[model samples]
Each structure stands twice: as structure tokens, then as C-alpha cells.
Target: MLVFQLLGGDLRGALGPGWEARIADPLLREDIALAAAIDPQQRSLDARSLAARLRGLEPRRAARRQAREQALQARLQAWRRRRELRRRRLGAGLTAVLGVALLATGAMYLKTEQRRQQAETATAQREAMLAFVTGDILGQADPYDSRSSGAAGGGIRAAVDRAAARVDARLHGDPLAAAAVHGMLGNIYFAQDAHDRAITHLEKARTYALASGAGDPAGLVQVETTLCDVHRIGGHLAQAEEACASALEHARRAGPGARHLATLKLGQLRSEQGRHQESRQLLQPLLEQDTLGTDPRLRGELHWALGLSARALGDYVAAREHFGQLLQVAKAMGEDSSWLGWAYNSLGSVLVETGEYERADALLQRAHEVFARTQGEEQIETQMPDAWRAEIRLLRGQWDEASAILQRIRQAWQDRLPPEHAQQQRIAASLAWADAMAGRTEQARAALAAVPRRNDPAQARARSSAWRTLRWSRVALALDELERAGELLDLFEEELAQELPDPHPLRGETRCLRSEWARRRGDAALAVEGAAACRDSLARYYAPGDPRLQHLEATRAAFAAAP
Candidate 1:
């Protein structure tokens, strides 16, 4: 009955009130007789006694039922507490998982957006750089178009200045575009012969190009090669050689065309440095290449360099051939009048050196006319031919005529060039020579003094010193200062030996002077031997029956007939 109550049993409710009367009728008669015999109190039982007993049992059952109800309520409370705790744990875990997922998604979205923005920014920068460079290129004058007028009536220089500023402002953030702009500006400056400015910008261009990954190797090579040219023109030979070597290294990796350009520049550099044999060796291979002949400008430059090297080496025949080729190329191009004039002047100079005075005079005159018409009279090109004409006059013993021509050239060069410029110094040396030839000893000394001394280590300075010493010796000889003349001659010979090869024309000229000095000293045997050697050298180098050869022959004859 207790287990049934605990399980919320209905066993007591299923027993009806008649269930006790039926159980008493079957076996109660025998059990009651036995209980009455054992205890006489069972016979005296009444309805009041049974009522009291039932009432007492009812209280106990009520108390038991109350305790069971309390236990069930306690179990129900415990089950509800466990269910709530499980629900709270599940909710907390779900919230944590959701928060982490949201954070990861937000971070990924932010990163993607940042990348997209950066890409867009890069695209904008590239487009802006392209527009800037294109605008600059279009605004500038055509480099090859000689007839094209200056920009906005301010001249090409003004236009370049404006374009340069714009490039700096618009392309500052884009290194590659900035390099290209700088290279273009450098080229313009180079064409104008503003060597310092050209070098500055070209170096900047090269620096930026390297920093920008050197995407265009050919462009870098061009920049370096132009730097080499600027340094060479400015007489900074060591810097020029460094630039040329760098350009050659880049050109070799770039392609054949770039390599060819670098090779030609190196040959020109070697020639300027007085390494004629090396220059010829470097340029000889280019002449045989079909690619070299295809580009007229390159072909002309190669021929010009070869001609100079050959002339320096005293190979007059080879020099003349190369100059002729250059002239032909210049004519075939017919683009720049300056090129044609330069070709004529170079060929004429070679002819003058070989003692073909008549032909040289004709060629030089033609060059003078061409330059005067093309580059104007005040230009350096126009003035150089006059110097060559003065040389011819001096060679013919027209000392006054040569001196007058040199005076005009000197004045013109002074007005246009720097005081210590190489061309000006050379003109000064020529003036001194002409004055000495005309027997103006004091004036020759004064003119030589006016020629500035070059402390710079350059081939030009060496040549200047040699020429100055030669002129000083001539003046000393005219004054009959034999000891001073001998000293000057010795210095001249030393400089010549250092600066020029044994077969150089200037060496032969030095021998002729030594012969004259020997004759004046009354050493007849020494004078005859010197004169004979000088004549042989002149005959071997100069054209047959040339005026210089005849002069040497006359000197030899005079020495033989003297006592």
C-alpha cells in the first residue's frame, strides 16, 4: 500500500465499500469465535468503539498522504532546475559560436574592401601618369623636324622649361614616367649642347630608371650613352669613360641595335682619348655589319669616327676614304644641313693634312658657304672653316693674311665662347703661330701669354701645350735666341712624344723645325741630315709634289748649298 501510494497508486480507490463485508462473511465466523474464546473483550464490542478506531486511522493516512505530496513537489522542482541549467548552457555556447563567426566574416569583408580600394588607387595613378607623359610629349617640338617652329613663340628652350615643370608636378608619384620625362628633357638639353644641364637630368633619369626596376633596358642604355656624350663634350674624360662602360654593359643585354650604338660611342671615346688604334679596332667590325649601314645616322657617325682615328694614325688614304663615305651618307640623308657641313669640313681637314691644298681649299670654301647659309655666320660651325682657311694662308707664306684671319676668328670666338674654352685656346695658339710667322716676336709672345693654361687633365690640354711650345720656339728662332728656341723645341718634342704617335704629322713638323734650328746653329752636317730625314717623312706621308714636300726639299737644298 505504501509503494502504491508513492507511485500515485489507485489500488485503495478500486476496492469498493462491499469488499470488507464479503471478506468477513467467508471466514469471519470462525476467526470471531476463536478471538471471542481467547479474549472475552471481543464479545462485548459495539458500534461506538469501531467508530473511534476508524477516526484514529484516518488522521494517520492524511499525514502520510501530505508527506508524499511534498516529496513529489520536491522532485518536480529539481527536474525543472536541471532543464533550465541545460537550456542556459546551450544558449551561451550558441551565442559564443555566432559571435566568432560574425567577427571572422567582418574581418574578411574589411580586408577584401581594402584590397579593392588599393587596386583602384593603383589604376588611377597609372592612368594619370600616362596622361601626363603623353601631354608632355605632345606639347614639345619634334626633335627631328628642323623646320618646326618653336613652341608658342618662346623658342624650344622656353617650351622645354614649361614641359619640365609640368612633368615634375604631374608625374612625381610615378617613378617610371618621371624617368622617361627626365630622359626627354636630357635629350633636349643635349641637342642644345647644354652639357651640364644634360648630365644632371640624364643622371637623374638613370637613377630613377634603376629604382623603378629597369623595365626598359634600351632606354636606360640610351640615357647612359647620352651621359657619356655629355661628359666627353664637357672634357670630363674619366666620367665619360665610366658612363660609356656602363652603357655598353646594359646595351649588350638589350639587343644588337643598342649594342651597336654603345660600341660606336666607345669608339668615339677612344678616339677622343688619342687611342686611335683601339678606336679603329672597335669600329672596324661595325663597318662589315649590314645593320650598321641600314641606319644612315649611325653609319655617318661611324664613318666620321673612323676618319678621325685614321687621320690621327697618319693613314691619310684610309682617312680620306672614310670621310668620303661619311659625305655620301650625309648627302643621302639630306635631313640636317649641319651634317652636310660637318662632313665637308672633316674631309677638307684631312685633305689639308695630306698637302692637297687646292682640293682642301675648295672643300673648305664649300663647307663655309653651306654653314653660313644653314647655321648663320655667328655660329661656331661657320667660324671653324675660317680657321682652316687661315692655316692654308700660313702654309703658303702669306703671314699677314693668316694673321688677319686668325685675329677675326679670335674675336668671334671670344664673343661667343667661354674665355678658357678649348676652341678659344686653340684659336689663341693659332694667332700666336701666325704672329711668329710674320716676325712679330713680341706680339707672338703676348698672344701666347693670353692663351690660358689648362691645368685640367685632358687630351686637349696636352695638344694646347704642344702647340704653345711650338709657337714659342718659332718666335725664339726668329729672334735668334738659340738657347731659348732649343729649350722650347725640347719641351715640344717631349709633349709630342707623350701625346702623339711616331707617325703623327705633328711629329714630322717637329723634325722640320729641328732641322731649321740646326741650320741656324751652323751645324751643316747635322742640318743636312735633319732636313733629309724631314723630307723623307714628308714625302712618305704627304701627296707627291705637295707644297709641304717642296718646302722640305727647299730646306734640304739650302742646307747643302750653305758653305
Candidate 2:
């Protein structure tokens, strides 16, 4: 306000002092102002005339500029309204997106937490199971305890039973743990050859492992593998086969190790079922690929199973190689004499089949000595050597010696074997052959009938089955039942045709029997042909100095010279 006052407020034409010179004619003054406001057109014109004309042009120009400004203002308001609406829509979309993101994040967090809690609970349950087994079961093995002292077999079984009794209460709601515990117990009983108890516990274990809501693939595979082994040993072959196949199916999902283990066990079962070629199909790959891996025990078991298949297929060289590998593995592992005894016994059986009698007898004697020392004289293993010794006697044509040995072991076999077993059938067949040789015609017939005939060609072509049929045919020939002998030979030939190679020792044995049948039928030419075939087949397997070779030569000469 002071500055405004000091500047002579509103002083542009104030007329303060000497106002007379600044004053002009009223009309002239108006004309001069109009001259300044308007562009200086017609400067010489009178100021009154210019003012009158300028006033007339100003209204029209102002009206036109006003109309243009109003139109531009209306366009700006329309654009502003559209921008506002777009901003609101973008804001709403962003809000919805943020809401969805928040919901997804919350759901993810809940899922992660739930899985973490479940894993922790499973871990705790497993730890609890380990503690229970270690503390509750194994800790009960105290000799000083009254219960341990009184219970059978130092209370190992009693302790297992006690632990099993508490499993429902202690490990409730944890079916996986229960399955593991029962599977372990069943394996324990299986190791001890307690088939009935093993079956009960294993079935229970499988039930828990295959439970609908709590199925455990690893547990299922392991339980089935063990059940296959136990069932096969207990002579329940069909059940064994079913269990083995199921184990393999589950093991495929489990892993390669599980698959290989299951396969090896199944191969052993197939061998027992007398499906020798099928057994080889499953087992030979394990040998060729070396898939049993670095576990000596598993490899050794595979070798033994392969040997069985090879021998049954009449591949003596392959059988020897497999058994030889088994013995080397067993010896390298520093296995007990019992395991060595089994290996030696396996190789010995092959030696017998190939007509290496001296080597076979030596190996069998070593096997017998080992069995006597490690297993004692009364054990089933002790009887294995005795059975093979009878085979040796029969091979040497000492029927009386073979008969005496078989008779001595009959009670032992009766004690150990089930009502129907391959080993039992083998024994019965051997006894029948020996009895037939001794001229006990009626006794041989009854003994031969007592041994069940294998119907499947896969079963009939096996080593034991072939030998049984050979015995049967020989008995028929001795009784002058040429027709029956011919039929038996035909069956044998059909079985061998399906599986055995041309140069197999089984082929040699087949030829020998055919020659005998042809000689009896007075078909001299066929007898000569069969004798020559026997010589060709047997030469590969039998030692040059073997009595069987010399016998084969004599037989060939006799057939060729027949009238």
C-alpha cells in the first residue's frame, strides 16, 4: 500500500499540476483515444470521424472470437470426461487383479504348510517306530529275565510275538509302520523256515501295505517278494507264482534295485515250477547284463538259479560256468561251510549229469563232509549228498547199492519234504528205477505211479522230470511193455523238442532211449541211426574215458551189426 501510494497511485493521466495543456476538445480527445486503440488507418483523417467508424467495427470482431472460444471450451470438457471414465475403469481392474493375487498367495501358503505338517508327522511316526523296535523288541533279549529263560529258542520268537501283540496299540493310526513291523517279523520267521507263521504275518503285512487309504508301494513290493520266496519253498507253486508276478509289477514302480531283486526271486520260483526255459528267460539276462550289481549274496543267488536253469535245459557247459561262478563268489565272500556245501553240491550234480563220475564223487564227498560238519548229520542238507550218491550208484549199474542208499534216506525225506515235492518225486523215481533193475516189477510199478506225472511240456522237459520219465521208460522196457515205453519216449521227445538244443546231453539221453526202443522193435536201421545220434550228442558233454562213452560205442556197434 505504501509502495502504491509512493508511485502516485493511478497517475497515467492524472492532470495534477498544469492540467490546461493536457486538456483538449472533448470530441478531439475522444478521436485521439480512438486513433490509439485502432490501427493507424487514414492518419490524416479527422479524429471524430475515425472514432465513429472504429466503434462500429469492434462489436463484430468481438462477437466472432467469442463464438470460436466457446466451441474450443466445449471440446476440452468432453475430452476431460472421457479421461475420467477410463481412469475409473483401470482402477477397478487393478483392484480385482490384486484381490486374485492375494487369494492365490494365501492358498499356496496353506498348501505348503499342510504338506510340511504331513511330512513332519510321517517322520515322527517312523522315528517312533524305530525307537519302539529298538527299545521294546530287541531290549527284551535278556537271558537273566525269567520269561527269556523259560521261553523256547532263547525267547527270540517270544520277543517278536510280544512286540507284535503291542503293535496295534503302540503304532495305532500309522499303517505304514505297522506294515513294516509285520513284514520284518514275517521275514524273521521265513528265515527260520517257519512257513505257517511266516504266511500269517506276511499276509497281515500285505493287508496293511495294500490298505486303500494308506497304501505303501515300497512295503508292498518287499512283502510280496518275501511271500513269493516262502510260498515257493512251502510247495505252494501257484500262490508263489502269483506273489512273484505281483512283486515284479510293484517293483517296476519302486525302482531298478527292487525290480532286479524281484526278478531274481521270481526266476528261482520258475525253476522250482519246472519251467526251465522260462526260468532262463528271466535269469540269463541278469548274468549277461551283470544286473545283480555289486552285492555278492544277490549275485551268488542269481548264479545258483541260473545254474539250475542251465542244467535243466541240458546246457551242461553253461550250468558248470554258473555253478563255478557261484562257488568262487561264495569262497570269496568267506561264506560258511554250509553255503560252500550248497555250491559244491550244485556243481557236483552237474558233474553227475555230464558223466564226470570221478569228479562228481569227489565234489559230492566234499559236500557231504561240509554238511556233516556245519549242518550235522540229521539235517536236510545232509540228505542231499546221500540222494546224489544214489544217482552215482545207479549210473554205475549198482542197483543194490542205489536201493540201499535210497532206503536209508526215505525216512529223512519223509520228515523234511511235503506230501508233493520235486525232491520227493525225484527220490520216488530213483527208487522205482533201482527196484525195477532188481526185478521187483510190482514194487517198481507202484513206486513209479506214486510220483506225480508233470503235464505241462514246460514241466516235463526239466532235468528232474526228464530223469523221472527215463526211469519210467526203462521200467516199461524191462517188463516187455514196448508200447508203453514207446509212448513215454514220445512224450520225452516232444518235451525236449520244445526247449533243448540239438547237441544237448538230454538229446544224447533221448537218442540212447530211442535206440533201445528201436532195437526192441526190430527196426535195425532206426536203431543204428539213434545209436549214431547218441554218440554225436554225448561226445560233447561226457569225458572221453567215461564208461558211458565206451557203452555208447558198444551199443552203436551192436545196433549196426543187428541182423
Candidate 3:
């Protein structure tokens, strides 16, 4: 029987604090004492015998005893009721007090958070003011000396970290502040080639900016724009587009000039999404606008993008001219620009395409030094210069150096960028070429197989480009797969027939692959004929010392000297 008194549980802790006094009232204590003194030795008087004795002697005495017993019973019941009421009141009062205390704690926490945000906002304003002034001073200083801050190699990073700590301490609870902090952190992470970390921070900034309310429209747009860039770099096309759309909306709401940056970002997003026509349409008008009214760095960047887009669309002559203009602008502005390396790298790429390998190598090498000195060994996207340098090494037949550079690029891309990114695919393909040259056929094939074959047309094009240059040609030659090599040659010929007219850019490449295939099959006559075809194409399309022509010459010479 689970009687309340015999229950195996403590009541004091359940009642919270101050339960002892209510349990120990005088009347309550007396009730407990009387219960404790319920003795077997004490007898209950027999009322019938008392009544009988009272009838003969003292009936009034029996009545008096009965009245005393009734009074005792009433007193015991009253004490028990008061004790139960006091216990109930104590419980209710304690619960109410604790609830109030919790509410007070929550209010204090919110107030502290608000104060912290205010302090952070004040600090950020101060830092922005300082940066503006310092940047102005640096602008006026000698261009080369402006880069030599007291912090030197790691100093800029150290300062950024210090500022980040301040932001964290003050703005951790403020959504807008956190968003700004996230964007700043993402910039540093991106420079360090820590794309995963950059993505994390950019995502945080995006979420926070969306929820940061209607406070600062410009700040919100900036965060969103930065997130869009991160998504593009990380190869999250859909997410990048979504972020750009939101940023555009914010820009529209913020009135004039705000949309300039949003427009630029939208153009970038469009370009990545393969909406090249739209991208060009969006950016061309802005580029035509007076350069004096816009940010010089942004102007340079826009020009660089236009040049790249032109190259992608196969206007190499126009791309070279556009890059030249961008390069001059960056050089003239000098310290006022952050796009110096970009200009150089883009110029170098166009030069390489135009068969100016020596100039391309020199420009790309300079760009590589600038990036390495400024951003360290990270920043893989910004390391286009380094990739070009490796390409140059491959062209020069510096097998060991090319192989090492390609290995580093593959590792960095796999570690930092999404595995399916076009840049990553291209790097893997290049590394596969290096492996093929180094006589690691199994490794080369493994690398080639890992390149994804998605249904997206742009991805298909990119894969095809990498496949033709890296796998199809090299693999067929190494494996002596003449039939497959002929099939690939026919496929390329068919593609060019649709995509372009006669004298296609890849004609030399196609002929070279076929020549290698014929040579591997021990058909000297067919090898010489294919090599001659490639030589003729190369002579028409490329410079005198182009590596493809040299390789073709070597192949022809070998065949002629054969016994």
C-alpha cells in the first residue's frame, strides 16, 4: 500500500527553499507529536460502561469526558488543514518567484547583447574611418612603398585577425555585425585558398544579412554580394544566383549607385551561369559609363571580365586588345588598384592563346610572384598565373617542374574547391597530362576517369576541352589505340564543322593527336603524312617557335631517320 507517510521520497527538495518553517508550526508540530504518542498502553474509555456508571453515580462526569474528546479531535483536524494550506501557499509563491527571476535573467542577457552590438558598431565605424585615411595616405605614397606596411608578409593577416577578434567580442549577437564580420573573414580565407572555410563564413554572412532587418541597406547588399562571389568561386551556381537576386533587390531598394555593385555582381554570376549574352549585356553598359564616377578598381575588374568573356566566345583578337587596355589602366592607377595581378594574368592568357608564349610566360611569372608575395601559397582561383606558369613549363618540356606544379595544383584544388568545379576538372586534366609525360599511365587514366560527365552544356564543353587536350590525345598515343584516336579526330572535325568554318584553332592539335596515334601504330608513311598536316596548320596559326610545331618537327625527323 503506497501510503503518503510511508512513501520513499523526500519532500523538502521538491518544495524548493524555505519549506522548513511551514512544516514546523506549533500546532502542526503538536499534531505530529500527538500522532507520535499514539501509545498501545493508553486505553480508550468504554462509553457504555461510563454511561452505566454515570446513571448510578455521575452522568455529568461522562458528558464532560465526551466533550473533551470532541475538542481534541477538532484541534487535530484544524492543525492538519492549516499545515496543508501553508505548504500549498509556499509552493505557489516559490514557483512565482523563480519564474520572475528567470525573466529578469533573460532581460539582462538581451540588454547586454544590445550594448555589445552598439559598441561593435562604434568600433567598426572607427576602423572604417582609419582605413579610409590610411588608404588615402598610401595612395599618395610611392606605389612600391605603399605595399611595404610595417606588418610586412604576415602583418596584414595579423591586423585582420585582431580586427576580427574585436568584431567577435562586440558583435557576436548582432546579425548585421556578424554578417559584416563573416564577409571580412571570407575575404581572408579566400586569399588563403581556404575555400571551405570561406564558404562557411560567407553562408553565415548570407543568413545573418537576410535576418538583420532593414537597418543598413548598403551593408546588407555588400554581404549578399560577397556571398554571391563565394558561391561562384565554390561552384554553387544556383546558390550564387539566389544570392545575387536578393542583393539586386536590396540594391534597388537603396536607390541609385547601390545597383552599380549589384549589377557588377549579377554580371559575374551570369557569366558563371553561362548566360554569356546576358552577362555581356549587363556589364557593357556599366563599363561604358564614365570611369571617373565609378570605382577605378571595379572599372578595371569589369574590363578584365569583358576580355575573358570575349576570349571564351572566341574573339581572341578583341580579348588581347581589351586586356591591354585593362593592364594600362591598372598600371596607371598603381596603388589605387587591387586587380593588378588579375590584369596581368588575363593579359598573359590572351597572349598565350595568340601564340606569344615568351611574353605570356614572363607576364604570368610576374603575376605569380605578385600573388605569392601578397596572398601566400593559397588563393587557388587567384593563382591562374601559377597554372599558366605550369602550362608554360609543359610547353617547354620541363617535365619534372611541370609535373610538380600540376601535383600541387591538383592537391590544392581538391582540398579547397569543390571536386566538380570546372577549375578543378581542368587542373586534374593538366595533372593527368603531366602524369602521362612522366610515364605513369595508370595514374593518368585514374585522373581522367574522375572528371565528372554532367549534362550541363557548359560543363560538357569544359570536360570536352580538357578531355581532348589531356586524355583523348595522350591516352590514345600511349595505349596505341589508333582506332579510338581516329574516332576522336573525326569527332573534333565534326564539332569544328558545326562550331566554326575552315582554319579552326584546334586543327593543329587534332592533327598532332592523329600523328602520335599513327606513329604508335608503326605506320611511318601515315605518321609522316599526319605530322606534315599538323606542321602546315601550326605554321599558319601559331608562331615560328610554338611548341606544337617543334614537336611536329621532331616527330617528322624521327620517322625520316627510321631504318
Candidate 4:
């Protein structure tokens, strides 16, 4: 235990350095180490016995102990050198890893900054593009540089083309600019009624707007309204309705009165489709306001719409009342020629339907004169004078003259008007009737076949059934198919009765057809019944002196004489 305590205390005291000094004798360190290893539990060694062994030791054994001590000292030095080398290598490796990590972090931060700057630049460019585009629109300036620069004969088309070109130029290398330009182009195309081109541009604009993240509600509404117009013009009624609905919904979310004009358009669409109740419902509230009511022009427009809707619903009294109100509004507004012409024509039609043919003739003539003054020698379809004159000619039995006038109208309208215009259909129907009366049966058939069919639900609901039955009856009569004509005329009567008012415009005509059919079949009682109904319906719309009523009376008398 004493020897063990001595070795442990001496080793611990010499922990840092000078182990050779602590040994005192050169071979003592090895002897102590060997003794500790061999018999550690033998705490004490005999000093006299160690000396005796040393004295008796062989020369070779003493040399071997010295060699063993030197070898153990060499091993300790080699192990320390290895540990120092390992530490230096580890420090170099750590430095390299930290340097790489720092460099990678700096590079990532730089790349992120570059991306952020690029995105900001792109956003700024988009804002600029929107400003320029919106400015061009609101300015109402000539879009074309040349047109705006005072070029002669600079039409709306020239202006739009110029603006479109400029917008396209600014779009170079700019996706957001491209989107704005597409929307602008769509607007131009829509103005020209180039629906296909408009659709292409609008769709492209929508894509770009979404891509550029410029999805403003107002901007979306503008684009949607244009698309709606295109669809409406194309006779895609359902699509148009959807577009309008979307626009209205968006407009409501945006601002007050934002959709006032859109609502008017919706009302017009409903009127055209024969939804009189809905049309009235939509416009009536709009018209009740002072802003719409007191303004002569707006009032006139409201009354005109109301009259037309009433007319379509076969409410002649209400139609006449509305038309009269429009006439008074026009006079009060000092709207002299074309506007008055329309009001007069509408009034005249109502009067004619109510059997006031003499009064109707005066109003029709007045409308014709007004058109001649305003529109010159050429009569446009929408020009009330032009159509009212044609109507007058037909009512007067000038079949050949009416046909010539309508054919001329058709030629003029071939390029100028949309294919689905209601006036065009009316003109075509009149032409067909004129041809039938003129004994040109095949020509009449062809003309009748040319009447375009409307898929708009409102229009179909309004007149398709009645008109179809009437058309078939005419066709059968033209073919000398008496049995077929009788059946079709009965169908026409029934269909007309379902839709028309008691004093409808077509009541006289329907009765005359039915009377004729019954007389042909030798049904005197039915013939008399139809003739009486015809006279009653005629008296409601025309005065006693009206030429149309007189002619009808003559026809009924002749048929009665046949018995």
C-alpha cells in the first residue's frame, strides 16, 4: 500500500512534465512501472532485496531494462505527436466547412434579392401599362396616331387601329403589357361587331390578366361586359345572360349605380326575348327615379321600351298609351324628326290594330315624311319612317310596290345590319306576304323560308308558335292544299288566341283566315262566326272609314253572297 501510494502520488505530481527527474535513478521509472504491472496489490518492495538483485544482475539484463525504459518513453512521445496531428487536421476540416456554409448562404440571399427586384420591376411595368390603356379608353381620343394627328377622314376604325397598334408596340418583352393590349384590342373589335376577333382578344386578355395578377374587379367587369355583348350579338342568348349576370354581380360589389346601364341592357334583352313582365319589372324601377324620369331623352327611351313590351304582349291599349307618352316626351324635349317618327309609327300601329285605320294612315304618313327628311332618300330599317312607309304600302294593297321597296331595303341592309335584327325579319315577312299576294308562290315560299329563326327563349315564347302556325297556313294556301290550309289556319287561330289580347293586332287577320277556311268547307255557321269576330276585332283598332276595314267588309260580304 505504501509503495502503491508513492507511485500514484509521484505520477500525479509529474502529470505535466519532468517525469525523468521524478524517477531519481535512470532505471527506477521502468522498475516501478514493471512492479506495478506485475503485482499491483504488493504495495511494498524490499529495498535491500532490490539492491541484492541489482548487485547479482547480469550485464545483459541491466541493458535490457534500460532498453525497455527507452522504448516506453519513445511510445509516449509518439502517442502525443499523433494526437497533436489529429487536432490540426480536424481544425482545418472545420474551417473549410464553415467557409463553404457562409458562401452558400450569401449566394442564396443574393439570388433572393435579385428575384424580388425583378418581381417589383414587373409589377411597376404592369401598373404603367394599365394606366396608359385606361387613359386611352377614357380620353375618347383617336386611337390611331394619324387620326389623332388630324388626318382627314379619320373614322372610328382608324382611331381604334392606331391605338391598338400603339398598345401592341408597348407590349414588347412585357407579359403584363401584352395582357392589357389584348383587352384593348378586344374592346376595339367589339365596337366593330367583329365578335370572333373580339372573343379571341378577350380570352387572351383574361389569361394575361390572371397571369399578371391584375385581377381587379372593375377591370374584370369591363372585360366581362364586352364578352357579353359579343355573345348577345352572336345570338348566344344563354351565354349572354350568364355574362350579364356576372357583370351585374360584380358591379354590385364595386359601387352604387355601377350597373345602371347594364341593368338597362338586361331589360332590353328581356324585352327582345318577350319577357314583358321581367322587362317592365327591371325598367320600371329604374324609370321611377327623377334622374331617369325628368330627363326627356331617358323618359322617351323608357316609354319606347315599355310600348314595345306592351305591344309584344298583345296589350294594344297599353302599347298605345306608352307610345303616346313617348310622343309627348319627344315633343316636350324638342326632338323633331327621327325620334318623333318612331313614336308616330308605334302609335299608328296600335291604332291600326284597334281598327282606327284612317287615323293610323295619317300617323303613318306623318312618320314617312319625317323619315324622308331625316334619312334622305334611303330608308334604314331602324328609321321608323322607312318601315312605317312600307307598312302603309302593304296595308294599301300595293303588293308590287311593297315588294320592290322591301327588296331594296334588303339590299341596303345586307351589309349594314346584324343578321338577327327584328326589323329585318319584319321586312322579310312582309316581302314574303307580298310575293304570295302577287301570285309568285315559289318566290313567296323562298322568302318565307329565309325568315331567320330566333333561339332566344324570350322571343320564342313571344311569337314563334303563333308565327309558325300562320306561316304554315300561308304555305298550304299557296300550294292550293285547301285541307292543309284549313287545318293550319285553325291551328293559327288557336295559337294566336293563347297569346294575343282580345283586341290584338292580328285578330282581324286571324278571323279572316278562319272565315275563309270555313266558307271553303261549306260551314256557313262557322264562316259567319269567324267573319263577325273579324269585324269586331277590326272595329276596335280602326275607324269606320279605314280602307283596310272596308276591304275586309267587302270580302266578308262577298263570302256571304256565295251562299
Per-residue accuracy of model 4 over 428-518 as CA lDDT, tens digit each: 6677777887888888777644433343355454345464456455555655657767665665565545655466656666787777677
Better of 2 and 3 by TM-score: 2
- Stretches off by above 4 angstroms in model 4 are 1-156, 165-235, 289-300, 320-385, 416-423, 448-479, 483-499
N/CA/C clash count, model 3: 1
lDDT pick, better of 2 and 4: 2
Which ranges in model 3 have alpha carbons more than 4 Å from their true place?
1-178, 212-214, 273-278, 291-293, 332-338, 378-383, 411-414, 451-472, 482-504, 507-540, 550-563
Candidate with more favorable, higher lDDT: 1 or 3:
1
Per-residue accuracy of model 2 over 122-183 as CA lDDT, tens digit each: 44434444445545665565534434222544354566667666776776577777776677
Per-residue lDDT tens digits for candidate 1, residues 1-563, read: 11111111111111111223212221222332333333566544343543343334336545756897799789879967985786687786577675776699789879978666644443443334334433453345453444423345344344455666676666666666667657766776665555676787889888877876646677688789889987876667789999999999998777898999999999999987767789988999999775586567678899999999988788888989999999887776553446678788999988778777888889899888877776567666687777787888877778889889888887766655665555666667666767777778898777654433433355355444455567666666766777767876776776555766676676777788898999999877777777777776766777767777777778777766778
Worst 10 residues of 2 by lDDT: 2-11
TM-score of 2: 0.69
* Index of the highest-TM-score prediction: 2
**Structure candidate 2, residue pairs in collision:** none
Better of 2 and 4 by TM-score: 2
Candidate 4 steric clashes? 17
Please count the clashing residue pairs in each candidate, in the order shown: 0, 0, 1, 17
408: Cα error in model 4, Å: 1.0
Sorted on TM-score, highest at the top, how do the candidates line up? 2, 1, 3, 4
